[model samples]
Target: MIPASSGTGLPVAVNGIEIEVIRRGAGRPLLFLHPGIGIAPEAPVLDYLAEGVEVIAPSHPGFGHSQLPATMTHIDDLAYFYLDFLETFDLREVIVVGVSFGAWIAAEVAVKSTERISRLVLADAVGVKIGDRTSRDIADIFAMTDTQFAEMAYHDPRVGQRDTTALSEAELLTMARNREATARFGWIPYMHDPKLKDRLHRVRVPTLVLWGESDRIVTPKYGRAFCDALPDARFELIELAGHFPHIEQPETFARRVLSFAGEAGVPVTAVKRASA
Candidate 1:
């Protein structure tokens, strides 16, 4: 494992679309796909992950400053774009870590091709349809009040609290942009791809399904099904956390990830925590 370091932030153009990317640490490449709400450069999960390996966290198009192509309208489009991204950067045997909506994208990319990725970790992922008619595959964050969503999304409510008065104009606008992108890709299918479940077998990479035991958004049962569908996957549960376990419990989450990858022949360090 390499010594600890922060990400080197920059923007790179991929097939005419400019995507914001942060690359840091020095070891094997570990690509981080951000959640639907987007990525804050200082997010602790990235920092912790970087402590152990080279971390590449890129903002999906339309999420941050990344430009969205006119033809890209669905999550699968993002998947294909990322596949191109992998090839463009010539990344091989990369370890992909994703959370919530981001996890969905990772799964999409893996199902399509694992030529670049060796292993994957999906935490509180929102994709695939396995719920019954009465139970929703994923919660409706759009319809919930801020308080309601916060209570459901985090184990500690304070973590989810956002003081609007402290926000800058740019931050507020970015939040709006994040919401818009999420709606375009996730809202219609309610955060899932109807056909994705059946296609999971195509994922040849070993996967780790991490779930927040306290998550009210997507149950562990759903997580189990997700693991089962994959050709090779195992499930791990994080206590004292909700949907975003990596944020709620960075130390435990990072250690779990690092340990999993290490056992699979990838060397990544798991040190003390930060904010994701």
Candidate 2:
């Protein structure tokens, strides 16, 4: 297991699978779970959050440098893997922040784990069925041009254009593999657990639903429904942003998250503004 540079890294073993976990900063443990499909656990969003509080980001097995088991098939399998993961790490009173597909996993983990999870932040999260509106399919996305893929992934079209040309062939292939894995788990009807909306009442933890105001992928309406379903939750929209708001508006995104973490008694400092 490679050590996470920000602090002493912890090699966590769960369900016979070893995950690389990086812990940085101090105070309450805030676990950041990356979205599926080409994202490593150490995504830039996690790095942005790390500046304020202790952040634990783990690479999902089979993605990045982590080990992948041959028998895994469903997203629920990943859910259980993380439940065991939290127990192995002895992380209690945790605050989980998940983006996109990771948000779905975070919700699953919160419901299944008996531990004390203080709050949950779902940013442009999936895992629920909306009436008449279908989530994007993996197969369709794969067929699109790189520009199309970028446009769908980001709110600002320029971000997509800027990054597409620089992506190496290896990166592109990894993205394809991740998409295939996601399809195996989330491509069925609804692309999410049908009962998840009903189960929101059982979550018990305070929840924050964040969305990109201009996100065409998931739609802002879905974000509101997710927030409304949770008993103790609030929704916020990041202006001029798309699906991945944290990347598009890092400063605002991080500030809002840090504020939420603080409200949950997680002891995170407010993000400091830089001088002009």
Candidate 3:
């Protein structure tokens, strides 16, 4: 059955899958890939980015109001779907931005082809294994309680809190669907793709890797290693923030992103700064 629109976005059929996309502003095109938990179309970061450039934020298939085809089950499948999305839209010289699990998808897409993409941004990404088999690089989100996840995922746990009692049935169902989809794509390998590390070199575009200072999910050290693997990439930290810096510091996150993408609409220096 076709689902209703997620209120803030429209559903577009891409490769036979109905994907919910939140499009805002106008100018340079920027594709915003969301985290594992899915995207809230009303996210402030999207508004901030839209001030300078067009922001197209799409909920991954199986998340939000999007459809999940039976054949799509891996992160690589998402990567290819995005490639097709770019082609279908005839988008060119686009800036691709991704957060957390979405960053992994962005990386996979960039490695495969950069024909449609111009610059890339990854924030608190987790898709490559940098340690020995016994070492745990990413925190086990599956095992953590809601409180524990909030404590680990945000510098201020209050910012990540959602009152389940206040949410509608649809909202609750979407949340569950997102979690299930996340596991389907990431469970077997425990997050990291075995071959993705070796293919990092294929992402030739200039890239920016942003990490939250207080993130326990994946430390800044791990972020640096992820950046180092790329041919040309720089690492920066968002102060007083955790896994989802975009949520914790929207203005700062947008400034860094716009600055890196060379957007003239939003004028802000891009450098290492404390307290944003």
Error of 3 at 44 (Å): 0.8
Give the clashing pairs for model 1.
44-275, 44-276, 52-269
| Model 1 alpha-carbon drift over 4 Å, by segment | 1-8, 265-276
Residues 1-276 of candidate 1: C-alpha lDDT, one tens digit per residue: 222335644778777788888877768889889898888887787778877888888899998888888788899999999998888888888999999999999999988988889889999999988867777878899989878888989998788989877999999988989899989899877899988887887777778999999888888888998887776788999999999998899889988988887784432223212111
The number of clashing residue pairs in each candidate reads: 3, 0, 0
Estimate every model's Cα lDDT from 0 to 1: 0.85, 0.72, 0.88
Q: Write the per-residue lDDT of candidate 3 for residues 96-128, one digit (tens) a residue.
A: 999999999999999899888889999999999
Q: Find the candidate with the highest lDDT and give its number.
A: 3
- Per-residue CA lDDT of model 2 for 1-276, tens digit only, reads 224465433566676788667777677778777776545444566667778877887767765445678787677788888877777767788888888888988887876753658778999888876554554422245367768767877877887574635789877777666666667667674358876766666676777899999776677888887777766678999998887887788778878888998882432223222111
Candidate 2: stretches off by over 4 Å? 1-11, 38-44, 133-143, 162-166, 264-276
Q: Ranking by lDDT, best first?
A: 3, 1, 2
